[model samples]
Target: MAERNNNEFEGKQKNIQILYEKFVILNRDLLNFGVSIEELKEICFKRRKTVHTVQGSQKNAQHSSFIVAVTVVCAVLISILLKIIFDSIIKNTLGTRCLLPNNYFIWEATRPETNCSMCEDVNSVLVFGNVTRDEFSNYAYSSRPMLVKGAALHWPAMKTFTYHFLKEIYQNVEGAYESIEEECQILTFKTEFRSLEDVFAMPESRVLLEEGEKPWYVGWSNCHPDVLAIMREHYTIPHFLPEDAEHAHMDYIFIGYQQGAVMHIDYISRLMWQAQLRGHKTWKLVPPPDCDHICSGISFRVDPGDIVLVDTRQWYHDTHIDAGEMSLTVSSEYG
Candidate 1:
């Protein structure tokens, strides 16, 4: 009975030892799985932070580019404004100092305030046939505006000066002439230099007379010798002008339509003569600044056949043309 009891105790001790070994193996496997889970969580957190940093850098770059573009645009506009203001100041200062003539005030004092009507008797303008050198000199010295009757009526130019004719001359003649590309305004005048061919080819619609728009005037003053030769065949120097003035060539060819020249003083030369060829023009003249208080403005009409002589330096003049057609004048300067 004692031996049987001892065998039972041994069997029970072996079973307890097997159970402890199995429990230790299971606890070691569970600890390794917990360490793997912690490593996976750390990798996921680092990836999220990297993505947030990249997105924040892209937004900052976009904001900086916008600021740079706005600054460049503002700088360009400021440069243009400064250039315009500087050019205007320089032009005005030079014109006042250099352009006013010497005897400008003396001539302005003697000008007669003749009523603007055409004279019925013989006292208005000297007829072209009766004009003498002495008479022309008297008017020139006094700085009076005169109308010479039948001055250019006999000239071949009066018959042949048409729009198409002038356009053909400008195109066929190959010479460098100053042509103005400008919008004529009463208050603000601006001109850009262009070639004669360019001016001829420009569309007429650019200068089409609109209701409140001023007429555009483009002219060529210093022409080529070839052009002068062609003009000389059609017209001759006035017989009444001084013998020394006979050498003077045609000075200007003013081309415009209605509302011809704006009211402004000519500061370049003393005396000028314009022969009306194609259309009628009306002139409005005011005395120089020194004589404005003593005399009032005068107005007169000049037809196609008449010649007008005036001291341009001493008067402020404006011109208007009859609508529906173009007005052309061939003019020259003489002393």
Candidate 2:
């Protein structure tokens, strides 16, 4: 009985020892797994922080680039605008400087107003420059005046010039003034041969002048060569009529101002330079409206040794002269 009791006790002790070893092994394995879990969690948090910082840096770089691009674009646009404005101002200044005659300036004074009494319903107000009256002259080299109303009628000048020119060439007829025997009358009004059509119209129409006892027509029909020859002698360079053999489609153009002439205006002419050889004249200039294309529309007039710069295609103007006065006006054209 005692030995059996002792054997049971030993078995119990061995079983207890085995249980303690198994418990120790299990506890160690549990501790290791927990440590690994904590380390993995720490690594994951660090990686997440690094990734967030990198993303934030990339975003900041993109924002900076956008700002720089915007600044550069703004600067470029402003530069372009300033350049355009400066260029326009320079061009305007240059154009004004270029407005001169033979590279020289010329001008004449206008007639003083006599008693503040404006002339009545001054008809046909616009003055044109570089216009030739050769087609309008009744006689050769005779200056023809253009009639201005609502429209400038150059037909009169053209018609008178053509009739006399044709008669002088084909009919070999002397002009009225040429036939006059009185020297005094010849000096007062002289004549030459030119077709009125040369200044105004086509040479297809026929006009009939009235018989004698009528006043001398303002247009050309006949003129004295001797009187013209005297006038020619005074010119810087004598301008004379060529023989019929020298006639061409485009020939001498007649241009001169009447002693007491009046003109109105609607538009300006290209350019002009005039010199007063004898008489005094007055001019009234109207400035162009800004909305109506001031640069393109302009005209010009002349006074003795005076230059008028006007926009040939624009502005309206007027001119008048006193009695016993004369003026020499030269003109030119441009784009």
Candidate 3:
């Protein structure tokens, strides 16, 4: 009887333990579900804040983009308006020539006092005197243009290459005159009957002369220092840069003649002081103007002993010759 009772009690105790385990599992599941709900609410709140921040940023970006577009449009419009205004003003100012007397007809010098009387009377171009040759030859440089009529003369330093080319010309040939082209020959302008003193002192030599029964040109060639030295033996001073002209320097003198009613072109570089030794030379000039297309050639006369300088790219000019005589000019290209 006692054994039966103990076995029944043991079975009852096992049932109680099983019920306790079932209750513990249900309680754990409920606690986990509650924690999950709280975590979901926290995530939803954070997402809301993030969405609001993104919306604000998008609105700011749109506003900034609109401002940039407006600024660009305004800038373009202003630029177009300014361009139109500037174009109209320039077209009105420079498009037409004035009827009044053009003052561009002046002597080629700093001062107009030295202009020849014949050159002064006409509306022709005039070349002017410069700082004394002595001043120009030295470092005492002046911006003054030597004048002929009332125009300004310009002088620039000579290039080293020009001197080299001159040396080549001298090294290659011999004679008093050399022909670079059949149409033009390098020659001297010597005159007779003038006092040996003044005649020898100047580089003026007549290029035109009577040969036999016809008037033929006496050609001079390959003018070198030795030839000039020889000529100096007969003449006085030939207005040339001395061998020791500078510390260690030399120069080349190129000769050109303006045929009757010929156009006087400005030089590429360097100021050309053209001395009128024989005959008269008329010049017309237009200062450097818009794009260099419009050429203003004013007429002017240059007389003997009158030095006129054409500053580099100064103007377009021309000359007229007496029926029988050729106009003589000496162009010195200085550095």
Candidate 4:
């Protein structure tokens, strides 16, 4: 009986020893898991008799959760601030442009007030035989729709810019045509081609205006550096523009048969000058929809080498190629 009693006491001592060892390991683990040393001690030593009590441990865990939430919220706020700063820097550094699509910017810009008085006395377009820089600045800079005769006659593009010539250059220029598919804008004015890829992939015989070929007209912006470089070599800014006038970095190219564009206002930034390189295009300029009563609309024909200037942003206009060869025009904006 005495030996049995001694064994029972020894077993109890061993069980308590194992429990104390486990508590020591748990304290070490809690410290590693971000629990404060004080809190760990309170959990372990203050309740040495009640090892299952997790009150201090729970408090530490709650504090840790709060700190994690605050850190996450601070990170989100910091990310938003950085994005705003980056956008402002990009806008200021890159010519104050929003770096968005042209259409997006146009939609954001407020439409200019159309002064019907400007178009009041306009019976016909102001045709300039030889417009000096001063005359152009004063008369046709922004208020009047004018045409400068023979403005682009010296350009090599007058005779050389044909369907095949343009198509070939766009194909040869590295990623020139592909850029349109990716980022550049293309207008399939009255055509079935949904993308530049579809336009370029069309059969050459149909593109050549053969018998009964589907007549198509398409317009696209030449934004690729290499493509613009080659095109600039063929043409240049009109000589009559104001000395300090600034032009857009890119130029618009319109090519194909008749049905140029329906009467509509251009959603561009500033006044535009379009050079008729091939065929004859007639311009019908109308006042804004709101000024139809006070303003007078007029029609004029733009011949090859003639440069037509208009504040297309304010005027509703249309164009239809006169019966002639395929029409091609290159245009850019200035202010």
Residue-by-residue lDDT tens digits, candidate 2, 1-335: 33554565565456556655754564454345342434323333222111112355766555445434433543454455455555544444333422221121121122222221122222323343443334322322211112211111222221233334433442343342333322211111222323332322323231221233111112221234543333333332111121331221111121323332222231222222222332344554443333232222222334443333333232234445543332333222221
Each model's TM-score, in the order given?
A: 0.55, 0.22, 0.34, 0.66
**Which pairs clash inside model 1?**
none
Rank list by lDDT: 4, 1, 3, 2
Overall lDDT per candidate, in order of appearance: 0.58, 0.31, 0.37, 0.74
Model 1 TM: 0.55
In model 4, the runs with Cα more than 4 Å from the true position are: 1-113
lDDT digits (tens) for residues 95-166 of candidate 4: 322233333345435566667776777788889987777777676465688899998999999988887788
Model 3 residue 163 CA deviation in Å: 26
In order of listing, the candidates' clash counts read 0, 50, 49, 0
In angstroms, the error of model 3 at 47 is 62
Error of 2 at 151 (Å): 32
Give lDDT: candidate 1, residue 204: 57
Better of 1 and 3 by lDDT: 1
Query: What are the per-model C-alpha RMSD values against the true structure?
Result: 31.9, 37.0, 33.4, 18.9
- Misplaced by over 4 Å in model 3 are 1-145, 148-223, 230-261, 264-268, 288-296
